[model samples]
Target: MTAQNEVTFRLTRCRRSVPRTRALAHAVLGEWGMSQDVLEVAELVLSELVTNALRVPVPSDRQVGVRIARPLEDGLLRLEVSDAGAGRPEVRAPGDEETGGRGLLLVEALAHRWGVEERAGGIGKTVWVELKAPDIVPEPVGREIAAAMVRPGYRLRARGEWRVVVSVRSEQCDAGYSAVVLGLDEGPALRVQAVEPLVVRQCEDVMSAAIQLEIAP
Candidate 1:
């Protein structure tokens, strides 16, 4: 597979995603014909990365992204977990009998090479790990679809009021389409879109309000 060949999962931020991250990596690596030992280590590495990623302070509706990639002509399997979050990870000395705080330390032990890189647009950073790939031929697969950033923050009527956009990525669907997933202060979030009539109605509201203010006696 080429360097361009990669798969990304946009994840919902929650405790349930810890297992979901492992499952997604297992499925993708299994399809690539990776060995059991390699799969196990990759899963462990990913679990730690995902756990720490969820710790970052991000909005409930914001998503974390995980990407699996193999660079062209490189014998390394790369795993990356990205989020629109703030924080640079650093290994700390865990005291004896310490119950936790050894996430990055485990990454260093398992990964051949690991580091942090600034994500595009400088909105966040990606923590990555590279492992030696077993001598196995990958199954034939096509490249994942490319998506463009549509909005930095899409304001829409969600949760019975207007709120900031959680995510907005424009993807091709025989032509073009986009969707929004918003979070509410309480209860479950909703998925909505701006259709033709909604667009026209909003324009009408804007005009009426602007003209109404001008009609003072």
Candidate 2:
């Protein structure tokens, strides 16, 4: 059975939280079997969030919180940093020569989406960013599209056979490749360099589910 990918850590509000949470993230993400590219970005994003949490003006009794989870189960990795501080974070456009105020800038550029949310207790807030796993590769055949055609339930023809697309997700596949999820088992997922001609159809019966997203700039 595949292990569930989720982790949470509460670190001291001191400066050491920066490196401590980063180490934890490294261990947890490695165990979750993330690729090197995904791991590199995860570490960078984790470090930035932890650094920001440590800088927040929280009381001495409160500790900084960090949560990492594959909430979507569709290749989306979420990294969150929480603090019981009064300040709400916002991205500031720093001048070219400025010394600071560019953390969220990197976050926005690397993450697919990001946002801030009030903690359940209402005294704190969690800053989060979702990073898409590097899996989906755009097939090079007819349409020069960047995304895959996901029609749930119906089997699609590819590589001279028909197979079901159990799930659809956006991934960071390089320019000319197609991401194929063979199945949920220990089988290998293929990133075929090119896709053969096939008829693509929309999933008519599957109603589009509206997800409550909290993406911010």
Candidate 3:
């Protein structure tokens, strides 16, 4: 089996990008059929990671990198946020009157494990977290069918809203596709592709559910 199912995003260093990254992660994880419990925890963890990354004292032109992945062999979801700044994040208990400095505390409490590492061949560091993913069985689908279903015009419903597939990319290392989708009402969303076999299957399952809903009376 492939090592993991993963997606990466690069966002400008701005306040608005926090929620945008969170929403994108939520959509991709939903397509993977993560349990509601896992989703809620993952979202909160991701938000803190991204928010902390933005607070790093990096150059204005530097972009923040976010990666979300799940190992194929285990029940864990991993999130990484990389920035071009050079300090390790410390988790300290916050005072009752303090209005800030609680991000890492929240991360430590919610994640099974998390740490900071030097960014591979990069200028700064990556802060990462792992969370237990329970009760998620990757749906199975043929490669041909998955490729056909994730094309640019494809539509799927997620989180009670319709989203249209805006783009698709073929993975270089494996027979998987990554797609970018936008909510019908929300403009310019992020990628929703699956790079591992298990994730491809789950993407197909999402499409199947959408098709069923579309045809229902």
All models: lDDT? 0.67, 0.65, 0.70
TM-scores, all candidates, are 0.61, 0.59, 0.63
Best model per lDDT: 3
- lDDT computed for candidate 2: 0.65
Clashing pairs in 3: 178-193, 179-193
lDDT of 3: 0.70
lDDT, candidate 2, 1-217, per-residue tens: 2234567779987777787877887787776677889888989998888888778776788888889887544668889989898878888899999988898889889999999999999888999999997552222222222224333443444443344545443333455344433231122442332232333333453324422222111
Candidate 1 residue 143 Cα shift, in angstroms, is 14
**lDDT (C-alpha) at residue 23 in model 3:** 90
Model 3: runs farther than 4 Å from truth? 1-4, 138-217
Kindly give the number of clashing pairs for every candidate. Answer: 0, 1, 2
Model 1 lDDT tens row, 1-217: 1112477888889999989989988887876778899999999999999898888998888788899886665678899999888879999889999988999999999999999999997988999999998554533332211112112233333333334444443222333444333343344655433221111112122332322111111
